[model samples]
Target: MSNPLGGLARRASFIDSVRQEGCGVCIVDAGDFIAREGRISDKNSIQLRIAAEFMLQAMDRLGYAAANVGEGDLVFGDSFLAGIAEGLDVQLVSASVFAGGARPFAPARMFTTAGITIGIAGIAWEGFTPYVAEHSDPGRPMAMAATADAMREGLEEIAGADVKVLLAHAPLSELRILLADIPGYDIAIAGHDTNMEPFAEPELAGATRLVNRGWDGTHAGRLDLTFDRTGALIAVAGSAVLLDAAWPDHPDMLTLHADYLARVAAALRDILAEYPVSPPPTGTRYAGVQSCVTCHPVQWGSWRQTTHALAWQTLVERSRDYDPECFACHTNGFQWTGGFTLYEDTPAMAAVQCESCHGAGADHCDAPLLPYSRPGEAACLRCHVPLHSPEFDYGTYLPKVAHPKAP
Candidate 1:
């Protein structure tokens, strides 16, 4: 499985379920368990660092076999990963990401369970090349070799194991190509690329079985393999477990989750308190939504009934009101000139107010006849892009909030 992104609520339960089967369990992550963009603060921010610590602690408790050192995991830099790796029970492996022509983490790890020696090798996507050049120390960019070379090297390292699995954090298409060229692996888990839907069943390419369980921690992939005494391939069953609301939260992980949530909330509150939000200058052109409600009563009422009116409240409910990544979409004129900054400063601008769509209402409220650009799909796209609202369709959504001109 891949792309857990700090979600720990349902993971432990899934792991426990596998263990309950009374069979040997080898839990491995393809890549991208840690979130790259940082959770409550900027990259490598203290808040993010704290969150990462909690996440790895949960992983340790769950007893992960091995996890590939993905690009997202490296976002906090090599030192942060090294610190986590030093204490982890799980082995972190990567054949591609290197410094000074040497692999920084384990290229492969061997696990013996139920009379089977399973060898798992990890290869991160080489896409981190440009990132290394910019964020790394001067004259010391991480060396990323060609994909073929990395896979060949990794395969050779793990060739002797009874059962070989390739934890590939590379493109799905490229992994398929490698499967053809390197037929030594018995199982391959793909990651890093988009897999909105999981495979219907485990696919056999050459002698390897390929599987990928989409991005995000919403779903997990499972493969149950039955091998003969000779280590000959026999039977394989694969399916995706949807970690929805029905799945009970792991008891221990739930406590950890709540603790981190509280920690992040406190950190955000402290930050906001130190730098309270304030309103724009009086001379600015952004008159608050109240300034427009007087004349545009119908439009104002219509907006109040829409989700936009409660955008800020949603964040408050989730304790993310001050979150920079979230606040912009929920509040009016975020980061724009003369726009909302912190809640203390721009209380009137809270929620996706009129200015969020119709541009600043200061001039319009003063002169109703003045030119105001009518918003279109582009305006909605600013927040409704794929990540948050993948199903968003312009024509289908516009009429839901459309307010016809007053007769």
Candidate 2:
């Protein structure tokens, strides 16, 4: 029901599965269905923007009824949202967010399916100003009102509908507080709570039911509501469906994903060609695994025996060698000092090499005894993060690629 954050393949699978059930279903997003902001290069930013464009296009094709505008979705700014909304059959709703002194999204959207009129209103939290400002163009900025105040006003406009559902892009704690003061909506679906589990117990407030599935499109939330002709709610049930490797990918979605990747790769090539890359700082030049072979032959040989040596090959096999996002973890020194830029430019740094965890090796190569920072937990965390390797543990993994401590 929310937070599909660029997992196009799984989302497509989920959508296909849902469509098979019947036309009585209408898909709605709580929020955050785009690329998130983090440490990124200009190239990474371009890729995210392109990916967001394709995501919007895909959502339109999938037939989403209403999608709440989450903070992460503001990366492209108000104009981009407006542009996509125009081309889409889906209506982007947000009571809290305003652009150019006017609300870019409708405060509420109505959908009629199976003789039930579903009223959907969206409310985004107030702390998203910095994130949007960081990723958006300087010329354009976003504005927001108080979440509770805005949603109160929005509910009035949609009160005529049979079932009222508030898509609050805020935490459960915050939603609970807001729902107390404004008690009109029958149900609320929330996002931005990264801790929620698929089977987690739902929080109930009088007749209202609050539902959420944790972040990152790992699972999808499904809610079925049965209402009488007079708009009185008779029954309501919700569950989270896991979208894992077992789920079949929709043929159309797979085609769309492949096309999107191709376009992103082409765009990246053009951007890289136009923007000249500056050299790494004085002490930050990377030395590939080969540079360490002479000094530490045993360690180098051991590393080759591990999966780290074949990082680039995995990406190559999947045809994701050119993808900046995937390359960050698969290659050495990616987005770091004297790291990988493009595959052709930094072919030697294609795999997870010696300098990936350890500091840049130019200084060490110049002077054998030159002090180099040892790889620590933080270094491992750069790539072995939760989203990439959920089971990665520093203590457990350190022994796998352990080498002699530098004196």
Candidate 3:
């Protein structure tokens, strides 16, 4: 996966080719899968299984035969994910997950094809462990030190079996440290670095290659290496592969994704969709002045008269604008890194409008629901007050927000 743009389709094509070529492919996921914006949450086993299956199928759609689950995965709880692992054909390898008493999970798993044994193991950052006891058994989050200790065992197994590669899932900061400390493996795959660019790092322990695949399977790390008849390294693997470009999407996985995603989209559409609001003058929807006219007409009127009307102007082309802490309060619309524009009001006429101070008017426009119109003092305090302070001077803010009375 290279660029996030056109990520899903491109990745599908790339992996499909790999599977067709019969080249043993390893798909490594670093972490943070469940903590995403679109993550589906459910209490039922089937629903949880469906969510996990959806993510797993995406990789399976590509040529990855196995994956090491990560921290964000903990958002769904251990038992549910573990159940998901049980249902999938892929292997779950993580030194950080401990399930004793004939636990269905394995700490590390080896994939063998054509007499070559390549074992993949996983260990998450110390902060990634989740709290839970799933499947009617006692389970505990593997501690960092304990996880490291367990990593040594997994590495030992790799050495004993003479596995050629090591795949891992953990934070980038921790992965760097591990690559330096553990020299038993030939290659290290990294994850949990949302900003990672999927490039190789300087060699560590005299003989290991380390790389990161950008999150959400947008970028895949592709390397070409050589081995002797006995599976000994002849030439080091080179060539960086990001899934952004043209690649094959596996057929089976696509079928699986199609089957599950159809259902997921159907169920989630109602919650996620933002229907057409009689769209405001600028195409952006604000709660409108009407909702709060009775309670705060003074403030609303001042807002109507200000330059803040074109709030979206600040957002034109700024997707990386970071969070809207100050700009959103003093201005209108929002600031995205891609730059802001008043889409609803039209660039020429876009102004903050009366609803800027109130809220999006779509819901309450038909009914003046007091609850949705105003968030009270707390909502205004985010930008008005100091961090971690409970006290806010609404009186001081009121002066700035509303026009001064006639002298």
Candidate 4:
């Protein structure tokens, strides 16, 4: 709830640079403005309206326009986001999502800063299809395939508006396909998928430029495209930089952080009072993945990517799926040593328990997170290029079986 006290320092330097380089400016956010951080809570939609208020204030002073909601936008549910969106001047662009007949959210402004027109838009991962369906009958679905079509259609419609920018909150895989077709998509921004790639990790997937800013606002990316009055791509300048110790601080951003901290303190006090924590209660369910690894390193280290570690997230993102068999394998919470005595019950989510398959957590848990357990046929069948478990055998596939030691 508390923001970094050093936020002011970060914002100050960034702002000073912008002030001197005044020009067309546009700012975009990759959704997730709200959330149940780390899958721990039922609902934790932290006053997105407040976050918006602070962000817009910074934008106004810095000079810019527009931002879109990411899937995390639904953390508090639709009605909540809609309520918070009021009073903000930035665009809440997402074509696939709608409020009745009107657009999901958007603004008339195309942010121009330092001679750049950032055509910003927001889209969610197609995987969210299940939740959105139950929430709003917008009749507009963002299927991976359908989204590609939407992007093409949107380009034709928005392109003529004299705006030459596009932003999306789709997954990396989906973005890859969208980028494959160029001219239709000039500059694309993405959320949902985290990427450490430099600016616009673009593939001339045909013609468009593609990039993802990763997550948690640790870094910001920019794409500056120069187009003729007719909207033909002339040139582009893009950069992605880390918001580390080196980045200059922003005084206003810091002030905003302090205000957020004060409010968080008051709200948290009330929450604690209402849901007072009991001393070591039982029968409780938690994401629990982070806690176990701390004590059981050797076994846990290898399981970081084990199928189980990946299981909870998959279910979190896709619980609506009708895969009963899979539903049982996945869990909201779990206990390892106890075993799945009750298929319908919560399962200990020790994050893949590389130990479970690897046999024991006696070793390897202490070292690195990379390829913790030596890869083997068993691990492979648990995940990637998975096959029937019966077909896999340890004698055949050794651990650390990188590059498919054998077929």
Candidate 5:
């Protein structure tokens, strides 16, 4: 799992280096900082809420100027989001999003840095208006206005700014229409387009220069704007800097991460205790790796040498062993009936095992020729998704994990 802490650490270092150059800097996020909907089921809402809270606290610590509110941030409802935002220094903005016929956050904010008065505004996609209404608290119904109309209103409020920037939480097609309709923005930072490759160079959308730094915290987009003596914007340049091992982890963020792990672990433990793993239907239970080793020693030995065997160790090293989201992929049969639950109770199901791919093997073990499932591309995709394995190619990867058939 790629924890945000590593990227945040690199960002901290990168920001300090930029400050050393004697240039004024401002930090902002495009939004969708929270986890996706699938990760926050009723069973694990408490754990994810703790994570969301930590994310906000960390953003405040980093001194973020502002962040847009994307759809993913609404999974917990507007009242929950508002309560958290009230305690943070980072301003949450969205011109399109409204609660009970009123805007939940300021449409725009002004920041004067390096003799430049910059006005930044945020707007969500109108297409997701229904989603906003569905997820909002019943007491405070949320609504979204037309994207272009919202952008126009937000930009109008900041018309006097020397430079106008927009944080647009919509797809590229919609963004083009918005820029075309509302023409004053100097720069637009795109969000909610998960498929977009990080823009190494800004794309011209009418008079506005649009940029996106892909999804996840793997990269940070840097846009350097040059203005003439009269403060007229003259040039714009952008690059996506990958947050990798080259940068050391920031001490402050590391402390925060440690606290997060401890708190999340404690919460998960309580949740698990309250709701014990239910029994799987008769004859469908998992028969751990030990059961397989007795029947096919060669395949079992080969599997031990593969990365899947050590998946659990990876999480342990990063102190993320307790996170249910990470736990699901790293361990076998997590959240599934008669599968992995707590490590102490289910040590045998600690890592990806034969049953994880072939389905629960208790029935298969009872009768050798009972027609066991042979996992195909779809099975691998369940765990090797884009976010976790962006470079995964089914053809290239299958061969690496292939084991000889039983004699």
Candidate 6:
């Protein structure tokens, strides 16, 4: 996963550079600031909650002016959100989100910087109600008003401001229609389109300039606004900066990250204890690397020379050996029957061993003729997905680990 701490550091550096150039900066998030939109599960709930808390704290430290309320933020319910918001320096705004027929956050917020007032209004898509219904707490049910109605009301509320911006947690098509119909917003920052990639140029929805930084904190959208002597908006330029390894990690964010990791590790240890590993049934049990070395010495030696043998060591070096997500791919038969559980508890299954590719060898060892699984494209693809192994090619990668059968 991409580290948010690194992204925050880069953002802080960018902000400092802009301010040093004698330009005023107003930082705001379009939406989805709490967590990613998905079902909450026992395995991930702890990590997600901790991550959300860290994100809020980091935003406060960065001095964010405002952030939109996306549907994902409702996963923890209104009470949890309210508790967190109470301690935040960032203003959370949404024109549509309501509970008990009343809006939970401000309809819009105004920020004055360098003698110009900027009005920002937040709006969530009406279609996100289904997501909220499925994942959100049933006790504190929320409703989304009509998008057009919300936009009109929000625009009317911020009419007196010099520049009007819409922070919308909706798709581009929806924003286009609303911006065209509303006809007032000078700029619109659209979120919720996960598939869209960040672009340098902004799209026009009527007269409003539309921009989206995409998801996952991989990039930050930048807009340079130029106003005339009368403070009337004259020109707008937009671009996106990639948050990569080039930027050094900010000291403060690094400290926050370490604290988050330590807390998550403790929570994971408890979760693992609650759900202890259950051994697989007879005939399909995983046989460790040592069990196969005697029978197929050549294959065992070949495997030891490959990167798969040292996968667990890589996680250990990075202090992620205990992380279930990272361990699943790095170790042998993770979460499977008789597979890896805790690192210290199951040291034999530490790395991708012979059984990781071939089927569990208990039956194979007992009866040599019994069919055993051979490594194939399907087997490799399970771990070599685009997110983790983007350059993986079945044809080219297969040869690197090819081993001869017994003569």
Best by TM-score: 5
- Model 4 per-residue lDDT tens digits across residues 74-171: 54445556665566565566655544444545422345544545455445555665655554534543222256554654565465444455667776
Which lDDT tens digits does candidate 1 get at residues 278-387?
44333246777888778889988898888888889988886667566577788987656556767887888889887887787676677788777678888899888654
CA lDDT of each candidate? 0.73, 0.76, 0.52, 0.49, 0.81, 0.79
What TM-score would each prediction reach against the true structure?
A: 0.81, 0.86, 0.59, 0.57, 0.91, 0.86
Candidate 4, lDDT over the whole model: 0.49
Query: Clash totals for all models, in order?
Result: 6, 0, 55, 33, 0, 0
How much lDDT does candidate 5 score? 0.81
Best by lDDT: 5
Instruction: List the RMSD of every prediction in angstroms.
Output: 4.7, 3.8, 11.6, 12.9, 2.9, 3.4
User: In model 1, where do residues sit more than 4 Å from their true spots?
Assistant: 1-7, 35-51, 113-115, 138-140, 229-231, 266-286, 381-407
> What clash pairs does model 2 have?
none
Q: Which residue runs does candidate 3 get wrong by more than 4 Å?
A: 1-8, 19-22, 33-49, 61-63, 99-104, 130-145, 200-202, 245-255, 269-407
On a 0 to 100 scale, what is the lDDT of residue 95 in model 5? Answer: 91
Lowest lDDT sum, 10 consecutive residues, model 1, at 36-45
Cα lDDT tens digits, model 5, 58-102, are 888887888888887887887788788787888888898888888
Over the full model, what C-alpha lDDT does candidate 1 score relative to the true structure?
Answer: 0.73
Q: Is candidate 2 or candidate 3 better by TM-score?
A: 2
What lDDT tens digits, residue by residue, belong to model 2 across residues 1-407?
22212255777778787778875787888888774434333555677777777877788888888888888788768777778678679888999887656677899998988777889999888777666556554555667778878878779878988888898888788888888778998888888776665442456865578777567667778887776777678877787776656666677887887888798778877645433445443356877787888888888878888788899999887777767678768887766667777888889888988887776788889898877767679888877765557668789988887866543
Ranking by lDDT: 5, 6, 2, 1, 3, 4
Ten residues in sequence with the least summed lDDT for candidate 2:
1-10
- Output the worst ten-in-a-row residue range by lDDT, candidate 3: 317-326
Which consecutive 10 residues in model 6 have the weakest lDDT in total?
1-10
TM-score of 3: 0.59
Q: After superposition, how far is residue 297 of candidate 4 from its true place, in Å?
A: 27
> Where does model 2 exceed 4 Å of error?
1-6, 37-43, 127-141, 194-201, 227-231, 270-283, 393-407
